[model samples]
Each structure stands twice: as structure tokens, then as C-alpha cells.
Target: MPNAAEILVDTLIAWNVEVVFGLPGDGINGVMEALRKNQDKISFVQVRHEESAAFMACAYAKWTGRLGVCLATSGPGGTHLLTGLYDAKLDQAPVLAITGMQFHDLIETFTQQDVDLTRVFNDVSVYNVQVSDAAHMENVASLACRTALARKGVAHLSIASDIQEQPADAAKRSKRNRPAHTPQDMFAPHCLAEDAELDKAAAILNDARRVAILAGRGAIGAAAELQDTARLLKAPIVKALLGKAVLPDDHPYTTGGIGILGTLPSQQAMETCDAVLIVGSTFPYIEYYPQPGKARGVQIDCDAQRIGLRFPVEAGLVGDAAETLRALNKRLEQKRDGEFLGTAQNSMQKWREMMHQSEDSSAHPLKPQRVARAFGERLAENTILAADSGQNTELAARHVDLGVGQAFGVSGALASMSCGLSYAIAAGIAFPGRPVAAIVGDGGLAMQLGEFSTAVRYGIPLKLLVIKNNMLNQIAWEQMMFLGNPQFGCELQPIDFAKAAEAMGGKGFSIERADDVERVLDQAFAASGPVIIEALVDAYEPMMPPKMPRDYAKNFRKALPQTPNRDLIEENVARQPAKTMMEAGE
Candidate 1:
């Protein structure tokens, strides 16, 4: 007979969870005991905050393409995982958050440590389940990991503390199948010979003189096809925030990411194009699309459910982008000389000029947005960029180059912070020897800074360029825009991140001036181990790079239709300044 905690650990191992990242507590003593005894079976990485633990797990999964696992205790411990899991959900990072509950009998009984774990975690995870009996633990655990991994999302598994201490017959345990890829649709789209579909899609592109390509994160797998499709259609590509860097910024088809905070080119592309092709993206905002009836749409995707999820479509064809684009390319009569794209290309050139001006090192107190641009210039075309939430994400989205074969990992829907280090680690492991770097904010950095150890332990040595703004800059901006006032708990006291890194078994350096950034970054690359380079970036800065906004007034104000329109919204915003919303006004 083995302890229930042992059974759970064994089940996690069987699920192929290579590493566990989290903190320990009284409720999970049994699990901790078992973890100590069976150290080799599953390695544990301790993090400073439960949020960081969750962040690390999400990163590990993203980098490794496996189920990233985390464990925490009851009450506050369980609650701490909420933010990180939400990031995992939004980013589509495959992470598993395992938490301990009080005695099964104590649930909803006014017990001291009891909290509705599933209810609390439901919003943050695609799936959240609580185990009642030992008989079903293995199946549920395996299912949770499999679902998170295969679906590339977050899943939560909670168990009673007392149940973890219960005895289990180790011999009775059974294993379940966990597969990564489903069966592929073998035949190419052209092979189907669907008569009117290809001809119609081809006709639509050929007829439209002014066309736009709206690409999203889903377009990543179809990068080459999308690029070729752009060439065939002569459509300028306007990417979603999550879609940034998929197409090289310098490409003639690249217009930039579109949204409230995006650039003028993206907005103009969406507004002016006569024909718009929605490829592998389900943009959340419909208003960002060509004004109703302004532009006709042709959507190509493998998932039919996503076709008309956001906007009305004149045509929706269910097919893989890579397969569909290749087929569509064959039928597409090369359009008239890139006249429409040429006009847009001129607009893109203006954009390039604006970026250069904004990124000039002359901006004092170094802007993170500028730093990202500068960093981009020095990074390898092969650099793997991993960005955390807040201004860092926005900056990266707007500035990072999609150099030839560069792959970026952002918490697409999850938008979690502190995911950078783990993601960089995972990126390093997934694509070994490629330069992996992450830009994180102070609040986000503090949330899961401990993940640096995982990078160091695994010998990842990923470069970290911390945008130390000492505040929840994103949220603060939201408050500024929506409430017309800044609020409390948005600022943070600076920490010696470099020293902290040394304490945590990694190298740490500080950058005071903007001029020192590139030099320090170069030095960091030469270092032997994982390094944290904290750049004391300017505070109260905008996350999106310095550029003329399509509608600055709209984005800087509360929502037109009033939702939870705050001034700023990004990943990781727990530690804020003590100033009251009232005090911020004066």
C-alpha cells in the first residue's frame, strides 16, 4: 500500500510530467514527503510566488510541447494559482495546476481551509476538476495532463489534503493513452477537386484590386503558405497582436498588427482593402475589422467553428492554410503589378521611419518599447523571443522582428506575465542553441522571477532583459484612460534583480542608462549561465511603441460601449503601489 500522495505523484509521472514547479505548504505535506523520497521520479522547481510556480509550468509546457505541471496547497495557496492559470488559458500554453484542498468532508462546511477550488479555478482553465475517490485519481490526472497538452491549454486538478494521505494499492493503478497530434487530413485541398470553391476563392482575389490579409496566431503553422498567398494575391498582411513576427516585419506584405493599440498601417489596410482574407485567426474585436459593409471577407481555415465567430464573411472555406494557400496559389492568376500593395508599401515605409525616430537612443530613462526595438536590431535572425504580459508584450508585439525563421511564443489568450524565462527555457530546449530572450515588467518579473532557476538548472542560460518600470504600467494606463485617474497598488519598490539572480543561482546585472542596454546585453550573451539584466526603464511609459495611432483618443479613453474598460490590462499585476486612486489624482 502507498500513500494517496504517492499515488498522485506516480500518476503524474505516468502522465509524463517531467518537472513540477511550485511551493510547499502544510496541506501538501504528504505530497512533499513523497516528493522527497522519490526525487528522481519527478524533479521539483521551487518558485518565489505560487503565481511564479504556475508561470514556470506554463513556460515549460510551451517550450517543451508537453504538459507543464505545478502543485500548491489549500486556501491562499490554491488561490494564488488563479492568475498564472488564466495566462496559460489565454496564451494557449499547455500547463497543469494541481492544488490541495482540505478534507473532502470539510468542503462547504465552514471549514478553516476550505475553498471551492474548482469554482475558483474554472475561469482560468479550459478544464478544472476535483477528485473525490482514490479509484478515479489516476484517470482524472492523466486526462487533465492530456487535455492540457493535446489541446494546448490549462487544466486544474484539485484533491483533498486528507485524501492525499489516504492509502492506495500501488499495484492496482492503470495507465491511459495521451496523444499529442490527431490524425491529419491526408489529402491536399486541391486534390479534393471541389469545383466552385477554388474557382470562387480565386476569382474573389483576382477581382479585388485592393486586398488585405489578416493573419493571427493560427497562421503560424501556415507561415510559408500565407507568405506565398500574399504574393499570389498581392495583399498586404495585417497581423493580430498574437500574430506578430509570423511574417517578417520588412516583408512587402507585412503591414503590422491591428487593433486599438496597433499602428496606422494595419487600420488603413483593414479599412481600405476591397477584399479581406481572414486566415487562421479569430480576432476578438469585430470593430477592428473594416467598418460594417466597408470590406467583403474571405476566410480560410481548418476549423469551421472559428470562421464566422467574430465577423460576417462573404465566403468561409474550411481547409488548412498551408494546403489551401498552395491550392489557391495554383489557381490564382498573378494579379496586376503590386499597385495596391505598393501604395500600402509606401505607408509601411513611413511606419519604418516613425519606428526609427522613436527608437533613437536619445530617449532618456530608456523606454521598454525603444529597448525592444534596439534589442531586435542586435538579436539573431534566429532569436526565439518569449514575451510576458503587460507593456513588455505590447512592445514586443510592435517591435520584435520576425527575422527569417524566428518563432515567438506569447500567451495569446492567456496574456500571463513571468512566462518569459520558462518559455525561453522551453524554446532553448525545443530549438536547441537558438538565442532565446524575454522582456518582462517589474510586477510580472516579481510574480514568477524564480523561474530563472529552472533555466539555470536545465542549463538554459536564456537572456532576460527586464523592463523595470516599478509599476503595473499596463493597468495604470488603463486606469488613466478609463477612470480618468490613476489608482492605488500599481507601483512597486525596486528590487536588486541582479543580486536576487545571484542568490537564486543565476547571474544578474543592472542597466541604468539606455546606452548601456546593448552593451550589457552583449555581455549577458557571453555569460556562461542564466542571466537577469534589469534595465531601469522609464516609468509611466506606453507599452505600444512610439507611433502615430490610428485612433489615439479612442484607445486612450474608456471603452466606447463600456465593458470593464480600464486604463491598462496586461498579465501579472499583483504588487502595486500603496497610493490611493484619490491620491493618484493629486
Candidate 2:
């Protein structure tokens, strides 16, 4: 008879989980032993930190659209997984987290490393439970896995140390090694919109002269439908940052990203369009949405609750984005007007010109955009980009164009830093042979620098591009834009990231001049095993939004410090003199 740990391992294998990311400790020794014994069926990725394990699992789920698993020991080990677990939860990725606990007899005894783990995990997990005993192991493991996959959220299970080694009950043995079911077979069916919902959405869409489509990650699976809908309505498609590559950036009707880290054309489309189609994205930034009462809105989302959460929805079509778009496409009449699309295209062309100029800058301290563009140009057709939050998000959103088959991943709703390296590790592990790159800011890299060792130890060929700007550039910009406050505690001591990589047994390269950007990037991309490339980016460059809110300027002037950093301010003004000057009304 198999022990509870063996039953848990068997159950995971039955669910088709091939890899588990985790750290080993006494609390989870039984499960670790089971994992060792079952090496032929599953691979366990050992990470230095429990947090990295969770982050890696989250990234694996994001990239593969499957249930990712992570394990941790009691107390601090379990607590450490919460940040990454929260990232998975907020981003709505499917992940199953398993942690160990003190023996059942130690309940409320205040034993070392013993805490109320179930209560601690309740907030982050969609489903949380403690395995009662050996008899319950199979059911708990199976249910947790299924629930995570079904709900598209985190599911957590904690097992007492002694319980993990107890033999399973004879009656429950049959369920222990059950064969896996396909995700589609095990989860709920993809919901389709009702005809009435489709008709109402079509009517609203058909009445508008200028229609704009805001596509999010939910719209990724419906690329063909999205393109057809854009054509039918003669609309300009604006993508949310998370949905940047839903359709190729070069699509004729596409205007690129919207919101703060978005393109000007996309912002213009949202501001000017008479009607908007919100598909599969609950983008929370209200300032970027069309002015209230100016445009009628129609939203398509699988979850009905998110239909009108961001903006007021005149018609909400609750269903899968692709199916809804396909149905809505048939009911709508093709609009003959091309003025809106033409304006968007012109604006898009201007934006592209600006981006090209930024990329081609011959400045001594390399423009970060140049690195992003050069890397985008050199990527394999199917390369996957894992972008960090902050300045790196802006750079990747504007500069990295996924050619035909490239994919992009980031910590979407949470916008967490330090995820890029772990995400790249997961991507490299999940999809071997495929090219994977992690685009990160220096700040983000500093937070998770230890993972560089993991990349080298595993020999995972992850391309790590760190933009060394020597400041928390995004926060520094926000200090001015949001609070009108001068930057404080945002500067950092420079580190030779290239040397750091070399210290960890990985190849490293440094780029200080514009002339060496392409050559160094090419060499980094071509090299096998883990590679880190640190680019000395222009510290003075401003991470400007397409448009600033009206209140931003008034607040900026109100809170402007008497002793501001003149050099920083001058550099920013020099880059976008018109916008900066106008914002100050100077």
C-alpha cells in the first residue's frame, strides 16, 4: 500500500504534471522521498528560494496554459510562497501550491515553524485545505489540481508531516493512480454568448461611425476573429499591455498598446471613437477609457462579473472572446468608411517614426528603447519574451514587436518586479529548444539576482537583458507625474551585472556604447546556456505616457519641490520638450 506522499505524487502524475518547482526541508521530507522514488514519472526543479519556486510555477502556467505545481516546507518556507502565489492569483494563472505542516498532534501547540497555514493561505487561494490523513490524500490532491485548472486561480493544500507518510486506506487506493484527464475534459466548458447578447452588441457596434476594439489577454485565442471584426467595423484595434501581441503589432488596423504604457495612436483611438468594444480585458485604468457618456461600450468576457467593471458597459456579451467575436462578426454589416482607420494608421506611422528615432539614437549612454528594438529585431520568429514590470514594461511594450510567432509574458495585474528571471527559467524549462528572453530593469534584476544562479545551475539557456539605468526609473517618473514630487530614494549604486553573471558560472556581456548594441545582443542570443547582457541606458530619458491626466500638471506644480534635481529635469525636458513644457505650462 502506498503512503499518503506516494498517493499525492501518483495523483499529480495522473493529472499530467511533468515538473514540480520547490525546495526541500524536514517538514516535506516524506513528499521529497516520494518525489525521489517517482523520478521516472516527474521532474522536480530545485530552486534556492521557495518564492522562486512559486514564481516559476506561476510563469510555467502563464506560458503553457496548464496547472503549474510548487511545493514548500512549513512556516517561513510556506509563507515565502505567498508573494508569488498572490502574483498567480492576481494575474489569474492556474497554479497548485503544496506545503508541509507540523504533525497533526502539534495543533495549537506553538511548536517551532508551526502556524495557522490554512488561514494564512485562505486569502490567496481560490481553494485551500489541509489533508486530514492518508485516506484523504488522493481526493484532496485531485480536487486541488482540478479546482486550480477549472477556476484559473491558485489552489493550495497543506499536509501534516506525520500524515504524509501514513498508508492510504484500502478503499481509497483505486483513486490514487487514476489516469489523467485532458484539461478541457476536467474543467468547465467554454461558455458561448446567447443570441440576444450578440444581437444587442451588434446593434450598438453597427450604429457607431468610429469603432475601437480594446483587446486583452482574453482576446489572444481569437486573433483571426479579432482581425475580421476590425475589418468589418473598419476599426482600429488597441491592445492592452498584457495583450500587446494578441495580433501582430504590424497588423494594418492595429494601433498598438493603450493606457499609460501605450502608444499615442491607441490613446487617440480611445479618446475619439464613438463606440468601443472591450474584449477579454478588465484593464483597470479608468483615465485611459473613453470619456463617460461620450461613447457607447460593448464588452465580451468569459466571466460576466468583469463585463462592466472597468467602464460602463451598454451591452455585455458574457462568453468566450473568440466565439463571441465570431458570432458578432456574422450579424454586423461591413462598414464602408475608412476615415477612422486612416487617421489611426497615420498616427501609428508617426508613433513608429518616433520609436525608430529613439531606437536609432547614437547617444553615448544607450537609449533603453534601442536595446529593446535591437533585441526584438534579433529574436527568433517563435521566441518568447518575459518582461519585467516598471521601465522594462514600457520599453518592451513600445519597442518589442512580436514578429509572426513570438509570445510575451509579464506579471500582469500585480505588476510585480523580480519575476522576469524566474519566468525565463520556467519558460526555458517548459519549452526546451525554443528561444526565451527575460527583459528586466536593473531594479527588478537586483530583487531576484539569486535566480541567475538557478539559470546557470540548470543550464537553462535564458537570455537576460538588464537595462542598467542606475535608478528606479519608473518610480522616479511616477514621483513627478503622480505626486509632482521630486524623486527620493530611487537612485541605486551601479553594479556590473555582467561580472555578476560570470561569478555564477554563466556567460555575461556589457554594452556601454550605441555602436556595440547589436553585435553584443547578437552574441548573447547566439550563445548556449544562461546569458546576461547589461546595457548602460540613458538615465535622463523620461518614461512618458502617451497623454497625462489634466490633474497631473496642477498637482505637479503644487508639489514641486524648491530643490529639484535640475540635471534630471533638464534631461527629461530635452527628450520630449513639447510635452514636458506643456505639462508645466512653461
Give TM per candidate: 0.80, 0.95
For residues 342-442, what per-residue lDDT tens digits would candidate 1 score against the true structure? Answer: 87889878766655655664556675656777667767767788888787777776666677777677666656666666567657655556788887778
Instruction: Kindly list the per-residue Cα lDDT of model 2 for residues 1-586, writing each as its tens digit.
Output: 8888998998899889999999999899999999999999999999988988999999999889888999999999999999899999987899999999999899789998988789999999999999887767766788888899878899999999988999865434344455333232375667888888789989999999999999999998899999999999999999998888799989888999987788888988998999999999988789889998999999999888788998998889988888888899999989999999999999899888877877888876677888888987887888888989999998899888886688888888888888889999999889987888878999999988988999888888788889999999999778877877777788989989999999999999999899998889888888888999999987767777776566666655554453256665555456642254245332
What C-alpha lDDT do the candidate models reach, one value each?
Answer: 0.71, 0.86
Candidate with maximal lDDT: 2
As a whole number from 0 to 100, the lDDT of residue 480 in candidate 2 is 77
Residue 64 in model 1: shift from native, Å?
4.2
Show the colliding residue pairs in model 2. Answer: none
- The TM-score obtained by model 2 is 0.95
lDDT of 2 at 175: 45
